[model samples]
Target: MALRTGPGSPGPGAAARLVVVGTACVLLAACSPPAPPQVPAPAPSTESAGPTTVEPTADPWADVSDFVPGLVTWDSALPEQSVEGDPVEISLGEGEDPVGSFRRTNVGLSFEASDLADERWEPGTSSLTPLIAALNQPSLRFGGNAVDRRVWWTSSDESAPDWAEFTIGPDDLDRIARFAEATDASVTLVLPLGHFDPERAADMAAHAERALGDRLVAVAFGNEPNGFHHQSQLDLALRDEGWDAEAWVGEAEDYGQAVHDRVPELAVDGPGAYDAPWWRAFGEAEIENKVALSQHWYPLWSCPDRSGETEERAEPEVENLTSQWLHERAETVFGQGKDTADNYDLPLWIEETGPTSCPGTNDSSRTHAQTLWTADFVMIGAAVGAQRMNHHSSLAACRGGAPMSMVCGMGAVPNESPRVIAQSNYLALLMLSQVGTGELVEISSSDPEVRAYAVAGEGYTDIVLVDTGEPGTDRAMDLSVDADRLHGISTLTAESLEATNEGRLRLLSEADAVPDSLPRGSVTLLRFSDE
Candidate 1:
């Protein structure tokens, strides 16, 4: 617009102004303004925002370690299964009776006297020694078929044969006395009832008293008269014995009464049967303090279809049946009775019991698991208040069959030795013995797979835990204690769930090392020091 200015000033100045304006325009054009490049709003995280979510993986059996302490009882025959020098150290509660292995009944190993003699009996403190030592077992019932065949009592034979000649002779009594002297065990003898000779039965009792003297506990009058009728039928068939049930029962009562009159303090027990008839009969007869009630238990009767054929193949249904049978029998017999501790009262003893009667058969009691189950039975029986239990085991050699042996069957077979070889039952006894003697305390846990029992002793509290769940299932448990009562803990576990042999008893040294997890199908004993 100012084109007509001074020739040099206006023209030059105007030109400079135009150059400046052109430079500013060029700079503005070169500096292209960055246009907003679009970015799709980060696809809403498929996962909800805040904290990164993590899905839990599939985990079954997360809480299977809970358990509760149950009742406990003692099987008097346990010590008889021990090796002599291996004297098991049992812990009894303070102020409790110092009870050791006491023989509650006497039943010879199902072998003849000659067979036992030829087995080369040993004299040291070993398993065999204990068996021989327990020969003086008191309150015995010698009326069974095997007893009639094996024992040569003076009543059966007028020779008044000593125990050396009989299945349990003077030599056996001497050994028992020595064992008692060493291990503090007592004796209970049950006289035989199969033949039912009162005079003969009394003579046998007199013979036992003469040999064992005051050491004798009591005499059991009959084998199992209540079930005698039924059992005799089967037993007679097995032994080819022409037995008359009615005649036998009458003879049994007479013999028992005779023994009762002769030895009132001998503490007799009887009607060792599964049914309530025996208890009712014994009560009705008014045997009073002179007699205690005795019973036999076989959680499983070895029927052809239900025999425990093999370790892995045995049916648990059979075991369940056995348990149910015992439980029902206990209720019927012990529950229906009167409450007084006098004339109308009688204490119950599980005189004879086991997994099977014919432990030597193909379907015999050879499995380790069977022994574990046996332990379960024993614990249950104790919980229910069965006074005492005697597991039927052979104390001598067997007399017949291939692969036939004591460890395999309930009956003693040929070539079987009583050196305390590992058997399912023996292992089970060991586990029970470890619990010692005490009033069973209470323990409870949430996991169904775990079962436990606590026993309080003078300086220790024993806790037994059994895991009955599937193999490899890990169980986590919270173990609480009476902080005021206990101080330290020691644990023992069955190293291998399938191991029924001696190796199953593995004592763990780390007392306070609570396991973060436990293997399936195991039993753990935790001892808490009272100090």
Candidate 2:
């Protein structure tokens, strides 16, 4: 007497139980509601959930396709929307020819050499290892302002000049070397040029090579040497005047010559300057010892002190992270380096760069704005013809730490556990690693806010969409790709753009593969694979 209504009235096992219950109810004469009118059992259909009238309306893609849940949507296509017949068209060539490969260490970390000297690294085991190793492949370069200001390089003899305040010994070098191996990263050792000593240079290079072996990629001679003249400290200043590109070239040549004289096989990268004139001069000089030309950069600075000649930048702000000016500034400045590198036939490396210079725990440097900026900035580096880039990092206290550090530790360098913590912006580095090493493809977008970058690999293509618009702003993109080539789609996004220790990653592909409101101030990675 129990009315059963569903896709299937009842299975055999279910019917058996129902029969037993009905018999007991009848015997007791207590069947509820006097048993409703008998109804026929509905047969189950395997072909479809039998036709139930569905109401539909103006949504064109309502019945187009079911959106595969999660980050991946396989065997499907996204509905492309057009803003008045204008949509961002992305063109991926036949996967055979690639302009160039975006190598494994294309995106890396830059650290001040003094950090190593400070014993901040606890090689083999540290909270920093997991995050770095997660990138699969990365490079860590130790060199920065501290190298000239306070740090000194001591080789086997363990010697330092009278002016040297702190010395980086074999122990420190070994610590960073061990860390690089632990994190599966390459090492680039930077030696100070403020006081050039050929013997010291060779000794440091030899020590780095012995400790790092093939893992040692480059022995850089300087860190933003162009700006050394601006250092207010009397001891830090390399030259009072006539410290131009030609002068840097001569000094770099001298350092390069000394290092190679003792360690001929060691690769050298140099002239780490924020300005481009040094790059031109170094390239023009054709410094034979140089394997790559590097430049350190920070679009803006939080520090109040600066040289009178240098133009004053607008105050460092979180909003500036995604500003058009930032991107243009990077392109314009790095474009010069790229041109010189190409002219000289050497690779251009952005050895030091981040959200800002010495942010010292600035809120803007640790926020989601930095995360989004990282996406835009890394792509800009790629587009600007940079062979590789190192985003600067620091664990020193905010006062000593730098701007745009991926993770900032509460305790000073050499702090114990519970003090080292990652910033929310680290999501940016994790996101960049997803693309891995692949050939970059061409993308054409009218709207710059939703920047598009595609990486073509063996049997797959990764498309990274960086939307820098605000939360309430409309950042919908009519992404055009070879739909037929899309076998599966994998994309991940954070729950919210605000600061949160706990990261919540979710898929944002719309049911029809088209959404009016994509997550603002977020990065979306889509992988199209043959499998």
**Which digits, one per residue and each the tens of the lDDT, describe model 2 over residues 1-531?**
111112221112112111112111111111111111122222221111221211111121122112111223232443332223233333333122323446556668888777786454655344565556655456678888777767777655567667666778788778877777766677777887777676777788888888877778787777777776755434457777667778777877877778877788888777788777877776666445567778777786635554433333444566667777777787777777777787877877888888776435555645666777787788777766676688888766644665467666666545644345555566566556656345566654445666666665544445677777664334344333333333323333444344533332233232234332234566766544322
Residue-level lDDT of model 1, residues 1-531, one tens digit each, is 000111222111112211112111101111111221222112111111221111111111011001001112211111111111111111222122211111112112222223322332334534444432222221222234455434655423246333323454445445544544432234456665554467766766776666555555456665555444454245443222344444444566677667666754445666566655555555555343344566675544534443234332222333332233444444444333322213455555566666554444443334444545555555555544444566655444323332222233223643344334334444444445445344454444334344445554434445565555433333322233332322323232333344323223332222233333334455656544433
State candidate 2's TM-score: 0.74
TM-score of each: 0.60, 0.74
Residue 252, candidate 1: alpha-carbon lDDT: 61
Q: Residue 311 CA error for candidate 2 (Å)?
A: 6.9
Worst 10 residues of 2 by lDDT: 17-26
| Local distance difference test, candidate 2 | 0.58
- Clash-forming residue pairs, model 2: 359-403
Clashes of 2: 1
The C-alpha lDDT values of all candidates are 0.40, 0.58
